[model samples]
Target: MSLTSVEALTQVRARTLALVAHLDDADLERQVDPLMSPLVWDLAHIAAYEDLWLVHRYAGEALLHPDLAARYDAFETPRSVRGEIELLDAPGAREYLRDVRDRTLQAINGRGPDGVLHEMVARHELQHTETMRQAMRLGGLLAPGEPHLDPLTGPDGWLDVPAGAFAMGAPDGAFSYDNERPRHDVEVGAFRIARRPVTNGTWLSFTEGGGYQRREWWSDEGWAWKEDYDITHCPDAEAGHPDAPVCHVSWFEADAFARWSGGRLPTEAEWERAATWSQGTDPLQAVGQVWEWTSSWFGGYPGFVAHPYREYSEVFFGRSYRVLRGGSWATDSRLATTTFRNWDLPQRRQIFAGVRLAADPEVN
Candidate 1:
């Protein structure tokens, strides 16, 4: 059954609230990392976005609180400086969110479905839910009750993705970010990819074998990043247990580890092919264990066009960022689809990032 716009919005809003229910006032206000917004900021931002898009843009209503436009404008204030901004306290933030949601829901009910804006807000909130979860995990304040990925129970081996042309991006008919557009065909040569993400135990071996100390396994840029950051091992290796996928790894680190294992990070095309393969029995597991790094740079697809949320994809189409596929444990399952494209700077390590090995068919 298709979900009515109101139902979808309510479901996603409930999930957003549930993710923050366990946090205390202090937890809500704390900025866990330089890269992530504080929980309170995120809370207000969700409401702010809903009001901005749904209430103001879709329903033709005036802004509930005009003062909030600049306060919660993410594009204006960088994450590093959010804590210093005069954000609402926990109670105030909740009150503001309640107000915005109340007004937005009233408009939705009165006006009926407002086309794709409802779904757009729902997806936006869901993405922030994952961001908040990552902040909680990084802060060591994550509630134990949150959902987790299942253990690596799938068959242990590499899956051979045959050499051929395959449909590469999200086709028309679904709501996908602009970067996943045009549904073009991509020619990928036969390659083998592990069924699961690289685990902490595997990464530990790399560290013990001097993976970080040796420059041969790393690209010149990667080696510089490693040295500049003084990264000797996975940032959270001591915290994450051995069997878990390593988290807080940069693309450079992921690249070095793949090379050290006599493999390489899969290109975006190979990763997507393995993920979307339908020819044989499905052979992937623990896809949401972590955001697996890919060799591809973040760029516009052929004939790419900006969607309604222009900055969502257009702002990052360059060599400055590398692509990541799949999703992390913090990701909402709805946003963790095969066609979703996530990218970050190669030097960023705070997010729930990890690696999956891929190799040429002959090498395997």
Candidate 2:
């Protein structure tokens, strides 16, 4: 039999804890980067969110630790300043999480699996698991083990994606984030996208050929950012193998590279079409290797409605953030669906962000 909501929750919860099993108290407490929460904070916050949505909201119970809500609130406490806030220590946080989980299990037992909240909480925890994985990588933690399957390989050239009207975003009955809601038809023109992400070797060529120093190859804003940050080489390049996808690149940088290669970053629609194309066979490759940047700004579709997690998508629906499709190796598979939307500031490059070149269809 397929796993029930409770079984799925239990399995994901155990996996979340197991991801941090190697960390010591100091490691758990340490903030890997200004953009990310401390490991311990994520651990506790996962349970806290579960408690808030599943136990309290759905079950109509009072918050077990109402006092601790502000500390874990993403809006109330910015990630950069989370270290200054007083938080539960390792053991205490673990105990608090256990208590919340126990209560959540009891609540789940009483309730049926038809509620959307249960699936929401399960997906929410899985999202955090990906976040924790990113934190561990940023903190220079070692990989847990070798991947069971060999790394995927792709063809050398761009894949032809014929233009057509395609349904974008998640379809009905599928559990998707609010941002991917209100599935609509999008008309995408013919385009050719790279089969695989730009590899380290390709990026090295750009760097060696003075890609960063050439102001013309970059936008006005991109040039300013490049000079301000003094970014000469790829971030974390030392750790990347030649065949590994190049990551930690900003959208501006990716755009510059695309321009330099006589192409452009695929618009969000194009990226989605290329990613989800099932007419003949799957043309794209190396999708989940890294979060590929697109040329579209973060925004909502027509008839979009904010779900229970309003702040999750509503707060950032504007031009401030760029859309990134696909997921990285650090992302949990459950949270890496085709319709899943990940966005970040154009200047931010700390995440597992990368590039894919897209071009207009060739004329005969």
The runs of at least 3 residues in candidate 1 whose Cα sits more than 4 Å from the true structure, single-residue gaps closed, are 145-150
Q: Clash number for every model?
A: 0, 0
What lDDT is obtained when candidate 1 is compared to the true structure?
0.85
lDDT per residue as tens, model 2, 203-232: 888888889888889999999988887878
Q: Candidate 1's residue-wise lDDT over 1-364, tens digit each?
A: 1688878888888887787787799999989888789999999998898899988988899999888888888888779899887889999888988899899888878787665678878888898887887788778877785435444566777888889999999977777788988899999899999988887778888999999899899999998887887888775665566777788889999888888999999999999999988886665788887899999999999999998867888888888999999998888777899999999999888667888899989753
Model 2 CA lDDT for position 29: 91
Worst 10 residues of 2 by lDDT: 142-151
**Candidate 2's error at 167, in angstroms?**
0.8
Q: In model 2, which regions exceed 4 Å deviation?
A: 144-152
Candidate number achieving the greatest lDDT relative to the actual structure: 1
